[model samples]
Target chain A: EPEVTQTPSHQVTQMGQEVILRCVPISNHLYFYWYRQILGQKVEFLVSFYNNEISEKSEIFDDQFSVERPDGSNFTLKIRSTKLEDSAMYFCASSQTTEAFFGQGTRLTVV
Target chain B: AQSVTQLDSHVSVSEGTPVLLRCNYSSSYSPSLFWYVQHPNKGLQLLLKYTSAATLVKGINGFEAEFKKSETSFHLTKPSAHMSDAAEYFCVVINSGGSNYKLTFGKGTLLTVNP
Candidate 1:
């Protein structure tokens, strides 16, 4: 079973520093997404990407957040300046059709 | 808009007992509902999904969910529980015909299976 894979299972960054979370979605999938879960909060959608551009984004996806499909296989989320609140488990997902497949997730910690 | 509500934050059951995790959904369009399980320190794993085709959806690990449109509910159930079934379960909803394609997840229900 092909699965979406994320890089750097865990990351620690200083507040105000940049962090890039990488993900390699299943090769044939057309849609990609980024979501995050705070320690005691629900998993919230950040953004969705298709056709190499952002299709939609939630209110939580502010200017500090950006997503890119740099290549055919790599999808990356870049946070220009991290804040303490940005520390959470960030998940990468992809879907060819209805069902979205999720990656193991990258735990981002900002101190 | 799409949203999911998991009724119980935590549920306890003994091994071999039945399990029920309640879920309710609200959607502006036709919905695709799913149940995902996340073991501690593990990624979210899809258990089952209910699209327009079937109301009773069966998934891995002997889990199944029935979609009740009139009730706006898609509840997960299992005939028997096992120790391995202890985990955090999330009920998710997505707008089937919408262009965004982002999933809205519930707070999650933590199932505790005791010996």
Candidate 2:
């Protein structure tokens, strides 16, 4: 079955540096989303993208966060200035409708 | 607002035994419920979903979930447990009438199957 794919399975970056996490959702999917899970915490929604625009975002998705569909296949999440609390497993998910499929996730570590 | 509650943090059962993972949800409208499994180092996999079509929904790997609107529950069950069934299970809820289809996930319940 076709699945969502993400790049840079693990990343380590400085606290103040900018980082971008990339995802290639299923080819035919129209809606894309980003979610994060702190270690030992429930997965939290970050943002949802559709038609090259953000549909909704949570408080965690503040000024530092932005999402882009730069190409037909790539969805990227950019963090302008990373904070220590931003370290978590970031997941990219896509769906044709309400049932979303998730990628393996990118583990972001800030120091 | 919609939320899901997984009753157990951890459940242990021997192989070949019946397995039950309890879940309860709160929704103001008709809800879309789902059960997802996450194996170690892997992404979340959808087990089954209830979209108000049927109350008893069957999914892959001999897994099934019952949607009880009166009880506000969608509990996952399997007749026989396997060693491969060990993983973290999450119950998710989504409000179809909402503007966005953001899912609210439960904290998760860890299941361990022994030989």
Candidate 3:
């Protein structure tokens, strides 16, 4: 079956550096989302994108976080000046309707 | 707003025993509920989902869930547990009435299948 794919299964970055986590959603899906799970914490929604624009975002999604669908297939999440708390497993998901399919996830580690 | 509450943070069951993971949901509109499983070092996999279709929804791996509107609950159950079934399970909810289908996940229930 076609599944969402994320790049760089794991990443390590400096505390103040920027990191871009990339995802290629299922080709025909229209909605995309980013969510993160801190160690031993609930998976929290960051933002949702549709029509190449942010449809909604959570409080955790601030100025430091941005999402872009730069191309037809690539959806990327950029974090400017990553913080230690930014370390987590970030998941990319896409859905044509109510049921969304998730990617393997990118483990971002900021030291 | 929608939220999912997984009653147990952890559950231990012996192999071949029945498995039950409890979940409750709160939503303003009618809700679409889902159960997802995450094995270590793997991505989240959809086990099953309950849209407004049948109250009893069956999923992969011999798992099933019943959507009880009166109780506002969608709990996952299996006839028998296997070692491979040991994983973190999340109950998820999304508003069925809205266009933006942002999934809200529960804290997760860690299932440990003992031999």
The residue pairs found clashing in candidate 3 are none
A1-111 in candidate 3: lDDT tens per residue? 999999989999999999999999999999999999999999999999888798889999999999999989999999999999999999999999988999999999999
CA lDDT of A70 in candidate 1? 88
- Model 1: how far is B112 from its true place, Å? 0.8
Writing each residue's lDDT as its tens digit, candidate 2 over A1-111 gives: 899999889999999999999999999998899999898888899998887899889999999999999989999999988999999999999988899999999999999
lDDT (C-alpha) at residue B103 in model 3: 90
Task: Answer with 1 or 3, whichever has the higher TM-score.
Answer: 3
TM-scores of the candidates, chain A only: 0.99, 0.99, 0.99
Listed in order, the DockQ scores are 0.81, 0.73, 0.87
Candidate 1 lDDT, tens digit per residue, A1-111? 899999989999999999999999999999999999999788989999888788889899999999999889999999998999999999999998889999999999999
True contacts kept of 3: 0.85
Q: Against the true structure, whose DockQ is highest?
A: 3
**Residue B75 error, candidate 2, Å:** 0.6
In order, what lDDT does every prediction score?
0.93, 0.93, 0.95
Which prediction has more favorable DockQ, 1 or 2?
1
Ranking by lDDT: 3, 1, 2
Off by over 4 Å in 3: B96-99
Task: Report the alpha-carbon TM-score of model 3 versus the true structure.
Answer: 0.98
* Chain B TM-score list for all models: 0.95, 0.96, 0.96
